[model samples]
Target: MHRTPCTVHGTDDRDVTTVCRCGCGEALPAAPAGGGRAPLYASPACRQRAHRRRRPVAPTTPADPPSVAPLLAQVRELAAVLDAGGRPDPTGVRVVEDLTGRLLARARSRGQTRWLPWVDAAGRERTALDDGDVEALTARLYADGARTVGPPQPSRPACARWVQAWRRDTSPGAQTYAPLELVPGYPLTEVDARVLVQGCRDGGESWASIAARAGVPVAEARTRWG
Candidate 1:
């Protein structure tokens, strides 16, 4: 008598795999020892299918954009205006100076100082404006009725002259003297002349320093002392 192969059934005793379903004379591995449930597979195809069934990832939201661009652009524009050497309104000068200091801080963080010229308002072509100069310009602008919150207009030549006068008078080492002639029209006092001459002597104050202290032009001081 011929014996038939054992049959496998689902855990619930249902037939999940058809027997020789194709009748192709080929046998497939039985599902499970006691049930028709599919066997756990460790093949590449099984892995790929398992990976596809994993939980879908949630999308991410982007961060908010920065808002300082416009302010920085405005600061750059104001800096350009100051760089052009025009007589700026007092209030405008102050604004420029404040903006310049902030911008300079940023530039310095990046290891640069060339931007100083862009914010300078002193019209000193060879050097950048120092803090004292910037403050002076700003104060002068404020005193001249400059609008506090808008683009500043250029001051008139007279206003510019006034600003220049203020700078000259308040500048360090600037002092006036009278009585003796130095330049064709600049008169120096007898005491001032004697002091100036002594200051220029071999071991005395340097002619440059004396000229600076006396507010005399260097060329005139050198000529008179020599």
Candidate 2:
């Protein structure tokens, strides 16, 4: 871990080995880097000992956890059935089982495994996803470890963005919201402008930045809006 690549065989070179690296000075086969890097440590113990001497390089940016929204939704549906004192519908149960298996296989392919959720929820042999297993998967996906018997709470679904309005009144007289691209002299209003600005903020746009683009100073913008 600490020692540099074998001066003779660097990482880019194939099938060659470096020294014991712990300075053991033995000629062992390089670590099992198929065609990648020349091996560095001789054995697990050697690598670990080197690790203790100094930290090994930090790992790369980790992969994001796989989204199991469909699986989570199915689990919730089944849970509702169980709560109602009725056996889970056989079709729905099968769907959850199949979805879980597919998600596990997909995650394995991507090397994005956290292991505990898949292991505990459905195990290697594929059992039904129980409450605890559901919670485990929920925590993994949502990062809220304390939630028990609760489903994962992800952000507002992207479909919300496509919906023209969340307000209740759709009557023509109700003054529906303006589109993002507002044309000049479209009978626009101060209230309408404020609504649009606030909606933009709610949608994660920064008013300060938008104002800056229009050559408005931050202080002046805030004075009018805030």
Candidate 3:
């Protein structure tokens, strides 16, 4: 669609002339013998310039957060579980940690990196993550000291004792890795009984009742399950 030309007053203010929409302040000649709408610009260059100016800018949609977002969210959720003294599936934690680390490394790599290995290995379908998401995840993961992978430090004597107790109380295959040793001066919390509550949920246990039994909020229990 083209714009209809606006008429402007001739030099004597007694006649009318077509004003170029290009703002050149020049008058346009009559449209060719055919009766049609007049052109807007004096020359092709002006028409091109007008077209460029009138072109609709592509609307700026915010980029989606990286595919690592859900993974990082899982990391935060797992960290919360540990913080709350809930024992997580060892295999699950290891898988999440490795995936998060690889994602972080790939984001910083100049070379190509396989993204979200777990998603691929699980044979589950997922939406592809874009460059924007990776950049965002990298910044956030690096900022969060708790999530960043660090060098392994020798377990403190207290942490060691806590681990021994944990082993004694836990049944075979119930325990995975030891609790994080990041809290040096703080006493370790025994794995809460709620850790086993997820099992009961499948046995027709009410969510409210399971949460009460676990001594954790229902939301926390759901987060743990996720």
Candidate 4:
């Protein structure tokens, strides 16, 4: 029998398998022994080519969506308005509207009612105010020349100075007054009388202002000072 140098089969020492020029390809060196197992190439080039064909390239992850920078900027603006201690500007109003919406949503989620405090002239505090109460207070402030319509401007130095004076009078030994209880003959000292006269002479000449400066009720100041 004649044997081919490059082709032989089945367990013979003389059998040799060359790189197959036929390109059906030799069984890879790392190929699993029969029984339907997969083939693995031993040549680096072949392995790399196989890997490129069989393994998938990873898809790139998407970048994070744009941040909450705009919302944060609006919140900062609202804070600035609050810090100024005046009514909010248009931007601030928008922010407040947004916040109010959020708050209402949260309250609805929690099955709760939002309540704000209301103080009465008798020093009683309540959780609600009627239209009448609001109207009365509004009228009173208007009459006193303390209320202004429309947007607030920066506080004037004169108004600020007046506020400072009012604050000073709230301190210990400073004069203070009740608006409704002023009446004549409510005990007055000589010093009190002198202070009352000076207070009247000062810019605090209104009955309420004079009484406040003298540490007496307006009614009392009018009665005694008269």
Estimate the overall C-alpha local distance difference test score of candidate 3.
Answer: 0.47
1 or 2: which has the higher lDDT?
A: 2
Weakest ten-residue segment in model 4 by summed lDDT: 109-118
Task: Point out the worst 10-residue segment of candidate 1 by lDDT.
Answer: 111-120
Per-residue error at 164 for model 2, in Å?
60
**TM-score of the candidate numbered 1?**
0.19
Q: Write the per-residue lDDT of candidate 4 for residues 70-170, one digit (tens) a residue.
A: 55567778788789896778866786666455444333423311111123344444443233354443443344444222135523443334333333334
After superposition, candidate 3 runs with Cα above 4 Å error: 1-16, 29-38, 61-97, 100-183, 188-226
- Against the true structure, what is each candidate's TM-score? 0.19, 0.21, 0.26, 0.16
Better of 3 and 4 by lDDT: 3
Error of 4 at 124 (Å): 5.2
Report each candidate's C-alpha RMSD, comma-separated, in the order given.
Answer: 23.8, 26.0, 20.4, 24.6
Query: Scored by Cα lDDT, where does model 1 land?
Result: 0.44
lDDT of 1 by residue, 25-132 (tens): 223355677777653343445546666667597898764324334445555666677799755567665765655454443433233112111222442333323534
Error of 4 at 152 (Å): 14
Expressed as tens digits, the lDDT of each residue in 8-86 for candidate 2 is 5455443234456765665667444657665667777888888888976777986544466677889999999899998
Better of 2 and 4 by TM-score: 2
Report the candidate with higher lDDT, 1 versus 3: 3
Tell me, by TM-score, which candidate is best. 3
Off by over 4 Å in 4: 1-155, 171-213, 216-224
